[model samples]
Target: MEYKIYVQNLKCGGCAKTITNKLNGIKGVSNLNIYVEDSLVILNCTEIILEKVKETLKKAGYPEDGEQNSLSSKAKSYVSCAIGNIG
Candidate 1:
């Protein structure tokens, strides 16, 4: 099954990489794709683990679709972007 989720605070390549790395660690997750411009994440996984995926993303600072981005998250994205550029 495929899951489409829009996340907030996804500002640049670093944010995308962080999200991709975290989600890829989850069981049953496969073919993960991050669309930075759209703040969207696409993944193939079992429906049974959908909530787990969402929870994992939330923990990683990228909340699920419809969740507003907090000030801290915005700041984090900026820092992430800088760090991404440095590496």
Candidate 2:
């Protein structure tokens, strides 16, 4: 199934790239797309892996919308953004 998850701390192409890389690496995820402007991530995966997907997003510092965006999350996002740029 396909899922559309609105996320926070998605600011630019770097964030998008990181999100794309992180999510697409998951075992059950595929055809992932990240919309930086809208803070959206769309992907195809099994229902059973949905929570894992969300957990991965949170760990990458791009927590789903309506979830807490803590200071550490923001900092981790910045780091991820930088790494994304370098990669």
Candidate 3:
């Protein structure tokens, strides 16, 4: 199944790159696409792994839309963004 998850704190190509790398690491995930402009993460994976995907996004500081966007998450996202930019 394919899922479209709108997330928070997506800023630029750096954020997109980080999200892409993170989601693609998931075993059941494929066709990962991150639209930073829209704060969206789209991917194809098994329904069972959907929660894992969302969790991964949150851990990476890109919590799903409507979820908590805490200060810690924003900080983590900035770090992730910098790392993504470097990579």
Quantify all predictions' global Cα lDDT against the true fold. 0.80, 0.91, 0.91
Q: Residue 48 CA error for candidate 2 (Å)?
A: 1.2
TM-score, every prediction: 0.81, 0.95, 0.95
lDDT of 3 at 63: 93
lDDT tens digits, residue span 1-87, model 3: 889999999998988999888888889898888888889888898888999999998999999999999999999999999998999
How far out, in Å, is residue 69 in model 2?
A: 0.5
**lDDT minimum window of 10 residues, candidate 1:** 76-85
Residues 1-87, model 2: lDDT tens digits: 999999999988888889888878889898888888899898899998989999999999999999999999999899999988889
Error of 3 at 55 (Å): 0.3
* CA shift of 30, model 2, Å: 1.2
Candidate 2: regions farther than 4 A off:
none
